[model samples]
Target: MNRNAMTYRLFPAVFLLASAVATAAGTATVTQPEKLREQPGSSSWSIMELHRRTTVRVLETRRDWVQVEADGNRRGWVREQSLSMDAPTQNAFASPTRQPVGTDLPPVPRTAPRASNHALLLSLGSAAPASRQDATHAAAIARLMGVPDANIRQPAQAELTLDGLRKALVDLDARMGDRDRAFIHVSGNSTRLREAGRCSTGFTLPTSKDVLTATELAAHVRSLAHRADKLVLLIDTRAGAGACQASEDTVTHSLNEGKSRNILYLGATQEASTTPANSQGGLFTQALLACLDGRATLSAAAGMPTGRELVDCTRTTLANHPGARPLVTLAGNGNLIPAPVMPRGDAISPHALLTALHAQRDERRQISVNGLRTNYRAGGKPMRFTLTSSQPGYLHVVAASNDGFTLLYPNQIDPLGRIERTLTVTLPAQDNQTRPAPRASQSKATLLFLVTDGPRNFFRAGLSRAGAFAAAPADARTLRDLPLEILGGDNSPTCTRSETRNLGPSQLLLCSTSFGSALQEITETP
Candidate 1:
């Protein structure tokens, strides 16, 4: 054979070898908690749940899914988007020292310092009243999280042109030191475009082009990540088709390839979706702020809310609003405190209070409240619900709201909360269970059903009103006490041998005799 013909054959073999090597070169870190499915599609049974920052070996890929081998040799398929590849050159932007047009760069710190929290907020739709409100609320949250006033910045919406955005990022990048924590929140409009067979999204600014591409934004984020111990990026905008997916990929790659191992990317909507608005503002923002509001009340004893708590609370608050499914990527162990824990206050949001209760909930004894309507209209049919316990126990049902807490069960008409394993109790005694129409302001509430080994009174002695089903007021402090009060408080007659588990900053308690608790969220319609 001629020399050229032999060389051609060798080239093909070399190409195949290089391709295989490339496929096997790197590992992936879970950015989102996802189940490793026995098969690629969503319907397949899950082998196990892969949590954030769990490293896995990628064995092969199939379009949107990748087969991976996790710890203990457990292998299964997960969505490609749920994992971030370890790619060194995947960052979208240039070095932090590189100044963009119309920005003055500050002196970059040369050495690592003790990590501190910093924040930068931008509101692109300054002309809109709602956007302005969101921006103001976001700034308050940053401060509550312990970001110093000097370390936080919020550029005027009118000045947030493409150049203005770059200038702000450059300034934040310069202010950040190695091992510091940074938070960047952008509340604005968004534009999506497809060019050169690639889809990219951008924040619509006030400049001539009025759009800052996702690639550019991610690059700046990457630059900041290099100096940060942890970083959180919150994008609240009207996302178009491919908007969330493209930005998520870009930001995920930015963090994965950077020195920072702990990061969070929270987006307001899914691909091609728009978040719904409420009197407070966008539902997503309202949910987020509500969660933040509870930080002081709901956070662990030592400090602020963890990344996991915020993600969980935000998800729970927005669960009822299908149009606002947040795209969350929490990439770290659950120990990272996103903010400083605030002093306890009565202004605690219901969602935050729920988070604290949820942290202590254990369902081993199997108790539930059923037939409760998720949504009720004003002047609607009578509300009816049944409570069942797998083991014999005393039932205490408390309804929590922003206004206060109420002992909805065991009221005057019923008086008896004790139940048997073989029996089910229906509220209102089938006589006085009907409720007066709820007002517009009373649109939401959460019901906590606690089945304990012994009877417990959530309300004070002798504060009942005159009615068929007279109930006493239970304050926020009463509800916040939760399972601990149920298990270890002096009021529990038969409780004994209570133990506590310290998880990072939060300490949860367990009783020798297990109790069951369930929560139901109620929404009122007009």
Candidate 2:
């Protein structure tokens, strides 16, 4: 056909396309097993099967079929009868625990014993030349990982040569096991570590020696494998194409060699990258510090962070880098408590405590975790919070229970980080289901709320990879699965259990900073 003739022939289809673009768009759920036919009619060849409840965007409509796109791709026609355009009020896919609106949601403490619990904190690194900050950063991380200052082997800050790295690794291996002994109980580890007492000189090696070679790192792994019940190795170093050996390869090999699956592995970077540097320390190391200290604003029912939680939470916040996802290797149950939630700053702030009460023109009654014990019987009414703020900002909630402290609000949903003047949240009481052991005595826990001018971007950014987590309300199961501690301690009888030990007043630590926080002490009696 002539060019003029072809132009006229295409006008009708072009007009239809323009019309579809000018209108509003909505999502349609596929009602049944149907074909994404090339054309709207049944005679057209089928492209693929469309399953039920699949959200498809509506584009244009014909007499009996509608053209839609599934998951932003694969355009085709679905019978008009097979598409539901109405908004779904409940979950697109049914969940087992689906109940009422608020009841279904709002689901969901402690320190570890000092002597028994132990960790082998090292700056998993290369024979790369060192900086003063490097040595200080390694020691700082060891402390955050709950390694007693006495047990840490300080590497020379000026130049960490290969031989020095080897000696440190060898000394670490010695402390973890004797000539005949491979594994030790927490009680034994406590004694051995205390006796060792900063035995590592933290000296730099001469320039000639090479360290962190794959073979040597592997040897260190072999010796220490299955050496402790609860072990955490924080690798804040380079992970090149194969340099920073991840938990994947090392952990699996250890398990095969009769090592405990109880180990939780965390690395700062992957593949030819250095742990990004920040003012306080390496960016990733700082994230780990924030998570361990409870400043990351993540909480679990289990009192403190689980191995998975620690890795996941810390990696999540470090997502600002282009290739910033850190490696988190969880073996077996993967619920190792790396540290306790020790909130820094005074838990009680006059401005934060009074903001809610003053909004009602009532006398501001201040309370703190140590202020007063509000007691209630187990299985009674759930503890409720009526939080308010005169100023506009985001609201953060964390509680210290029999398990450890963790973040409560802003779990995937509420991304805006906005809060109302007043809102009510009902927390499940001390039930046998989540809280630790015999609900026979009065149990006490504390809740801390932080009010910030804008979003706790770190918290939200860290949890971004957990798709839909931001949209759903916090629940018991979610708490348990959280790579960190969500539910309080599972309390299973094992040398190394799911959660960490209880926190004492001595363990209360701080994060980098907080805008303002309010603390509440809740006492639940049997």
Candidate 3:
């Protein structure tokens, strides 16, 4: 056909296409299994899977693909051919005519192939010299994670003014990618006010005329959360009794409520509680630094601590301070490693080691191991514990300490680990002819027990003849599978035991997978 004839022939189809694009609103149901991709092309990375019948809000159309906002506010693109324009009759997707109301949606953020980790370590220290100290320690922690110094922003105390704070936040946002990890630590003095049954908190910096309110600060940090895979916020604000006496919402609540699930907040104190005065630094910051640096131990996997570890350690560190309550709100998985503190002789990243361990644990089957006491005086009596199981199985116990792993049970003196439904064992068996002295100094130990349907020999080659203890390998793979293993040495990351601290005398140290595992902590004092 000639040009004039072809133009007339395409006019109708073009008109229809314009009409469809202009009025493309409301929701659509997935016709089949589809990929929610990062971009409109099929070659784009899949953000998530859109199962059959999943209904999503249709934001806009791009030729063969359509942009959608799915559950959890996840925005991505799905093939138009995979979607049914008909919206669901019920649930959150019921309103086909309803369009998103309120602020204009920001462009979908893009994540790099290998995301980088960033930190904003603001001193905010005007009067409190300790705030500056906290910043230094936090920077050290960030360095361990391999975050470059340029990625760690430490604004001067004088630059903490209202305008300066905004500029700093903007600068940080510019540096962050969608998949980046963010660590934000703010240390300063704070004030809380209660009026008309509402509580408000503000950071009071001597250098700034205006106090930085929690609400204002959260607004800026909230944006960062949307751009990062994980954002850990550490607030070490020292508040007076007058600011903490009121019974109401806390500064933490204001900072994280209805925010992104990627955010993990660790505040110094809760509402109606004041941070104890610490000459070293903010009490929470001090404990955090200790946990990150291995000086203080709460819980660890492959020699690296998780977010829960930091929280548990902080709670313990502040337990003695009257009216001091450390506040923690974990919007993300607390089990995930917050800091990648690569300790000496450790070749594995904390996340990889934990992931490997988790794959070995079995959650369906459970075993409980109990100790006589969680605490013991140094140079006191030898430790003893009982293992209980519904099913008879072989037992393997390993002790973890600062010195490393030692196979406590199945040793030279008592070789057999065969157990019935219940068994009680002593550290230095009475059957032993030579008596070993008690622990000379104060230290903490985690006794991990793995009971399997069949016998599993882990670290058998490393066991010593005299003490009946085996030294574990320093490699990551051995450390990962050592927790739980069955006969024949299969890869079992199913029963990766999690570590927790108990307020009482007896604490549940670790619980593993289907292999039936348990762990208990023991404190030896001098």
Q: What lDDT, from 0 to 1, does candidate 3 have?
A: 0.57
| TM-score of decoy 2 | 0.35
TM-score of each: 0.40, 0.35, 0.43
lDDT for model 2, on a 0 to 1 scale?
0.42
Whole-model lDDT values for every prediction: 0.56, 0.42, 0.57
**Per-residue alpha-carbon lDDT of candidate 1 for residues 1-526, written as tens digits (9 for 90 to 100):** 2222322442344344445535673567676678999999999999877754455667788999998776434678999999888543211111234434444322211111111457788777534656645655565556555453334567755557777788989988776544456788877666677634566667777545567876788778777766565677777765555332353444455555653434566666443354444323444555666566552124343223666666676777667554666565554334345553333543555445544444333334677777788997665575677777787766777666665455667777567777786345454422334454446564787887777655654433222443544343344334334423443323221111111121121111112223577888898777
Per-residue lDDT over 1-526 for candidate 2, one digit per residue giving the tens place of the 0 to 100 score: 2222322442335344556644735557565667888899999998767754445668888999898865214578889999878442321111234435533211101222122233333332333322223334344344444343224444432324566556766666655421111111100000001112221111112343333333344446555644443345554443333222233343334444544443445544333344343323344555655465444545443334465666676666666445455544444334545553433332322222223211211012222222233887666675556676654445666544544334556544444446656555544343354444557678666555665433443232122222322211233322223322211111112211111233232221111111344656667787
Rank by TM-score, descending?
3, 1, 2
Q: Where does candidate 2 stray beyond 4 Å?
A: 1-138, 144-146, 157-163, 176-211, 225-227, 240-259, 273-281, 320-323, 331-333, 342-526
Runs off by more than 4 Å, candidate 1: 1-116, 195-197, 241-249, 257-259, 270-279, 295-304, 321-335, 342-526
Where is model 1 poorest over a 10-residue stretch in terms of lDDT? Answer: 106-115
